[model samples]
Target: MPANLHAILSASSAERWLNCTAAPRYEEQFPETTSEYAEEGRLTHSICELKVLKKFTTAINQRTYTNRLNKLKKDTRYAEEMERTSDIYLEHLTEKAMGYDAPPLVNAEVKVDLTDYIPEGFGTCDCVMIGGDTLDITDYKHGKGVPVSAVNNPQMRLYALGALIKYEPFYGGMIKNVRTTIIQPRAMSEDDRITSETLSVAELKAWGESIKPIAQKAYSGFGEFKSGEHCRFCRGRAQCRARSETYTALEDFKDALLPTPENLAQVEQDGQDGIPTPAVLTNAEIGDLLTRGKSILAWYNDLENYALGAVLKGEDIPGWKAVAGRSNRTFTDQDAALASVIASGYDEALVYERKPKTLTALESLMGKKEFAEKIGAFIIKPPGKPTLAPASDKREPYNTATADFTGVTQEVLF
Candidate 1:
């Protein structure tokens, strides 16, 4: 669906504004930016809408569907993965509809209103299904990083609320249940890629009530300024004092390591550890710092990028300025350059280097199914390098003891 207008309190960004309260107003100064990934997602979503309309409804004739699909396929960003992923999403919708006794009323890319709760909030639901006492809302995510959960997800919940409001007149308060589903085919595992959670109408309404005050505060732009994981997508994150304070507060944990005058004097003689502070940290300190490690890195990079952009625009910062970095030379015409190199007494082999395509590239070249059918058996996957992660991460704990001896034998070593 083409969205030419957006509400100030859009349902899609509810989580950010709901948490930060001041993000919506603060973000107004920054223009929205798009990336190749976002463009690809929009293309994939268009494909999904077309798929649903063709499969479930009689609105589109075969000829129209074909022509529309053909036009979409011609987009430069279109890839086999888009088709494959959209099919996965369609299959999930089909399975859900089939589980019901009779065909459920389905709507694709339906525009929904949330003005009953939030101030002028409206959004487009990817798919909505109404049957008996239940309403199902499915959101398709094209991201590959974290697998979004349907449980307590504010975006999904808000969409569900908007959906209920959109169909309330027709259902006449008979709809008692709401189910929100997130279909992320690009997630790492099959089991976690698609997830669903059910909520009663009362529960959903209660949640809406809980956020009404916060929504009002956000709309008025007079609420508290707080920072957390939700700050990732906020345009003001780079300069927000609250977010900067959140990371700088970590310095308080280092009070124990503060250097004394005598300790600093010892460092004057030789660069060695001082006497006042212990060289090692306790497990508690490690645990405390580890919690903010990922956020610190992300915040640091965002700040750096912002500073670079500011400097390039001729803004002055004390002791800081942007300068040209190193650049590598490249041939304007690679084929001609290579041909010249070969003709100039250089062997053809010396002028060119050959490398095999990566597995991902090959998979994209030959659609996923064909790639698996042709050479899946020949592929081997090695264990990944160990890295630190939080306890709440979905991946299993790494076992250093087993990993050390799994492929080693004493006889071979001897």
Candidate 2:
């Protein structure tokens, strides 16, 4: 298998390395491993590109599109959910393209070269559309675990900069603004599924200028090692000395002021006397503790994984040992087991229960257009329960008073 290669200053990790400038060099020691999730993302991206190309270009034949999709089906990760999500991505692009007065120039899998800002910097753009004075860059995100926003996103801005550089000669003076969009159909909240940010040409150019030095410093491995939430995806996170020192320092600080049972008792006694307890942390101190708590948790998880790996390899890790985890019993041969069960006594109907195909599966089997035309009216989506999210989330805040309770009724027992 070929090794998955990454650019030294790739747009995807701009958020990480830009913040923790020394992470790239630190991460260089570890080999890159492609997870099943990464492969699924690759497959979904390919599907999205092919679908977009088919819709935009007249030269592509139906057979070509079918062949591409058929090949994707061979991947174990391929599923109806992927097709549905990719369709939503394509729909977003199509809608954006249609809004233009003239037919927009839509390109998929666009190669963006960003050497001007970072050394040998380059990345592939999912979709790019240009018409009149506006350029739209849309990125398809397959992962639904975390919601991504386009506002001040380094990756998207870097893409916009590269796109600007690539098309400036052709669309100079005509392209005034760049719109960067992230389409994550699997996002939990409907509003969070699609988010956009628009930046003027002047703003993009200024941002490019600001990051030029930072990129150069990062390339030369001559920058400070600052740890933050960006460390979540860093390969060096487990062993990075800077990150270790950061967590260790914070832990020491926390230990000094952390409330204990004794301190709580003293605090309660002080409160009874109507005196403020000095043991309580200030607002700033509490905030700092909370921030460090997240880093500590992440570091602990990394340490646990490292220890587990060490133990598995017969390496001694002082206080830890690997052991067999719980496993559930399963039939060795499901088909034979089912057959034996049927022959003995159990009815086939009792053994297996039939279930209808999911909406996404049905749509994938039948063409999305035909499925919508025929069964669209049968679909009804109820409002989802409200959940807490960051203020930055695009979702509107749920209003308790405005919620419908028509179906709910009160009951009384005699």
Candidate 3:
């Protein structure tokens, strides 16, 4: 097999590259790195692939499957969670396959090419299914930090387009509709685990045409620099000049509001504390500030991290130096320390604090179905605290009246 080389305009990073066309070239300065989370996700994907091959196709025999699975389980990073989550993923695939009137064509770990639209663009689709007229492309997201939506998701749509191109010759262009799905089994809530969106073949092709120019610009390293939430995963996000300028735009707002001498003189004294206070910001100003303020904290943290990393590497940064951060003390040998405490006339139970497993932990320990069946009635989800979000946020607005009535008593009056 040929070595897997990432495309400059790969489908996975399409969102970032499409939005900030200059990101792909800028990110080349940073070295590639992987985290434990990424390693675990890779292992999980391997497991899912093996399960799909064994169940959906005749690619592997029983003995081979068992041997491969056991070897994977022996890896240090492997955990029972991987097995349980992969099982759920397999069940989902089984159900999807069964839903078709006839057994649909299923494939796992499919490599699709998109050179026609994007220059050398390619990606690995986790699962692909083709029934009579619909082609389904499903991606397994192992991370649990955020829920991914399939609606107008660029990555998934790109993958769908690539899959269509790859299967065109075999299917003779019989595919009419395309379905893109994201499965995040470890999501915080069960309802959010799966999300799917369907588009007709014409629509998917139209979207591909829409991005062809952007893709060419991105591939040629001749695109404009833009920044937004898409910068989160870019390798050079911390050092990107466009991002720095975007966040620092907040500095201009201060000049917009200048306290005139007359307004300063009109400053009112607090009746209770007798402290002079400047004129309060208008509601419109507050809204404007909030719009810019949303990204300031994240940008500040990224800048601080970049500076600290540079300083640690012997680079001199004016007014900034790396110092040892505070850390908590821990017993070098916890078991030995606990034993010593027990021998010093202290009860062994006092040295340890007992607590029940959290609902999430319990659900992981026992499978989700078993946990629900055993103690479903005991579980409850209280209303979440009110949080500020932009108008584009999907969640419904919180009701102040309902919030005030919660945990408070109301007396009936005649």
Clashing residue pairs, backbone N/CA/C < 3 A, model 3: none
The estimated TM-scores of all candidates read 0.78, 0.82, 0.85
Error of 1 at 96 (Å): 2.2
* Model 3 regions lying over 4 Å from their true place: 1-4, 188-192, 254-278, 343-345, 401-414
Give the clash count for each candidate: 0, 0, 0
| Decoy 1 TM-score against native | 0.78
Q: What is the alpha-carbon lDDT of model 3 when measured against the actual structure?
A: 0.84
Query: lDDT of each prediction vs. the true structure?
Result: 0.84, 0.83, 0.84
Which 10 consecutive residues of model 3 have the lowest summed lDDT?
268-277
Estimate, for each residue in 11-122, the C-alpha lDDT of model 3 and write its tens digit. 8888898898888888888987788999999999999999999999999999999999999999899998898788888888888899989999999999988887888778
Better of 1 and 2 by TM-score: 2
After superposition, candidate 2 runs with Cα above 4 Å error = 1-5, 250-291, 354-414
By TM-score, the best candidate is: 3
For residues 178-212, could you state the per-residue lDDT of candidate 1 as single tens digits? 99999999987565688898999999999999999
